[model samples]
Target: MQSIHFISGLPRSGSTLLAALLRQNPRFHAAMSSALAPLVSANLDIMSSGQEVSLLMEESQRPAMLRALFDTFCRTTTEREVFIDTNRSWCAKMPLIADLFPDARVIACVRDVPWVLDSLERLFRKNPYENTRLFGNDGERATVYSRMESLARHNRLVGYPWTALKEAFYGEQADRLLVVDYEILTKAPEKTLRLVYDFIGEPWYEGHDFDNVEYDAPRFDEALGIQGLHRVRPKVAFEPRRTILPPDLFKKYEHMDFWRDTAGSRANVLATKRATREDTTTA
Candidate 1:
């Protein structure tokens, strides 16, 4: 692969769906949560001062090895010209990515915070008999309020990526990021996708098809006890529904979409904050 980009942002914010669409381009390789991050992270650990072997490793080789992970992962796996690795951890590792892939950009897939929580809760309830591994135990999943509290903690799924996205959006390297919202991705796919191509300096693919899409990770989801968690629908369209969250909890996070308040954002946003949903058909 010639260039490696990233797909990151809040959980349940359509990163997998973005990857599904990107993979439609013959020259692009995109997937849900590639192994590159974990590989690079492990290498970073043993190469750091935390490991005595660090004394024998040269500082120059660190970037080389880390960058190799992306290249090797792509080259060995696919012949595609570009690779868009998906991982929420990438948002927290912006400095490392910039140093390694100087010209690369990170595409942050985001959604309204309340909807993010709703998506997770929906998945949990979908599999009524199985408890999702998203929480530590039963008590954590005891109620929608508890689930929301756990998910919104600083280190958990939704909160960590949200925080990391904020850091990247406001940090010195903010210009390396592009914020694309779930609403736009699902409701206005072609337009949103073309914007992504422009953002990454890729020529737009004209033959893109929004419907007849396919993406699923049954094994991955089953392992997490959250079947269909990473699945994308065959048709790309938004299905608006009433908030399952209790009124107060939903109200608390409905306005916490930090990406919307772009006053000081050096990053470019490709979406409006939550729009007034309508019943019109996107197809």
Candidate 2:
């Protein structure tokens, strides 16, 4: 691959929208979450097992085999020169990616934690007839507290990406990360895309109509019993509204965004803060 990057971070945080916008560039190939990470993990387990067949494989060949797996999985026509793989788990696999492709970067799309949960709640309320596949078949019947608890648990939505992002933010490979705030992205897509292209060392391209981009997989959403869950509107404007959650619940995570702090590097803290001020003033 000429260029490879990973799109990860919090769920319901504009990852899908970012992928849709990136695909507008003919030179880039971007999509929703893929199965490459889980497939690679499974392959590692199978190869390292204590079975007799495992003894024949040398440790030196493992890296090549793993690299080949990604190369084969992401291979495409010559028209596409850059590939953006989307998966929330990629943040946790940053070390492995850095080791395999030293020049690869990760773009983390993030938003407020309360808003993320609220978005999920809004979907749940909208599709009352179908149980969301996110928390299994019983998601429809799950209470608000239960759903929140499940999301806050380790390896789940709020827990996994938050932990993994913090790890990458403070780790040695922090320079290889670009933290994109959802607020800024929706409010100023051109500026955000320019920043992204600059970070990736690619020539900036125009002609992307963020206002009319359509991104949704109806069949896939139907399979998950959550239609319109991944849908993005035709425009990129931010619609400020009241929180769907109770006051207490909304306040619980109102200050949960750690990227807003001054400590985290490789983030647009000032821009995010400015966005927050503008949002508040508009509200």
Candidate 3:
């Protein structure tokens, strides 16, 4: 089977752009997100139901069925040799993924919590004609405080992914994870991609042109009343802009990114070293 990896982390953290640049390599297959995780969850629920019929199935059957499900879902018609499945939920499913695909890795794209919320709010204002499904379809009409509260609550975008990423970061599967910062990725695409290639044990390809990459998910975004939510600009450069959020609201999450150390440097060195050691041993 072709190697499979996961792309997850906080929303509005450039997962789409990363996928776009990675897809530029003809040997790779990647997208904004996939339904495989939710599908697997739904199937597991059915099999684990307390009903007598469900109880009849052996415990071993569940894993085998899920393995088959992923194999079938990731199977492609093209010659793409690597599959990078994107989804924020995957951060919470690291244990399951580790058990299923022992060699698979998860590349988590992350950014400051305040900026992530700000990015979502900016998009909300840009599409004033329709309400986004993000906050129950009334995100635009909702007050800033209310919207912020909803997103910061546990199990939501800012909450769930942040908690999940941290869980995996400090958990036993930390070595199988790679945290990519939004600032570094946008400001230095080539350097970041090289690090990613090294982490995933893929041969480096210098053909990537971050400046002209194109990516968008109009159908998915439109269905959620978020027109350009998943869109990536033609260029990969980061243009600093003023925050649209209230000062208090922004301050509440301004210092919430836990992936960085006290000195504000990325703190996943241990995980990176482990990945390097594994790559070296395998190579």
**Superposition error at 47 for model 2 (Å):** 3.1
Task: Give one clash count per candidate, in the order shown.
Answer: 0, 0, 0
Model 2 TM-score relative to the real fold: 0.90
Q: Per-residue alpha-carbon lDDT of model 3 for 1-283, expressed as tens digits?
A: 7788989988888789889999998888988888888899888888887866577898889899999888888884345899889998887898899999998889988877777887777777778888777786465347888887888778776889889888877777877888887777877789899888888889998789977988888999899887887888888786666777787887787656566642333224312111100111000
* Highest-scoring model, TM-score: 1
Can you write out model 2's per-residue Cα lDDT over 1-283, one digit (the tens) per residue?
5588989888788888888888889899888888887888887777786855568898878789999888888884334889888888777787888999998889998887777877777777788887677785365247886777677667776778888887777777777888888887888888998888888888987879987887888888898777776787778877776666776776676777777664756543313763221231010
What is each predicted model's overall lDDT from 0 to 1? 0.85, 0.77, 0.77
Give one digit per residue, the lDDT tens place, for model 1 in 1-283.
Answer: 4788999998787888889899999999999997888888888999999798799889898888777777788899888899888999898899998998888999998888877887788888889999888999988989998999999998998889989998999988899999998878888899999999999999999878898788999999999998888888888997767777787888788667778878987899977746442221211
Better of 1 and 3 by TM-score: 1
lDDT, model 1, position 39: 89
Choose 1 or 3, whichever is better by lDDT: 1
True-vs-predicted CA distance for residue 8, candidate 2, Å = 0.3
Compute the lDDT for candidate 2. 0.77
What TM-score would each prediction reach against the true structure? 0.95, 0.90, 0.89
Clashing pairs in 1: none
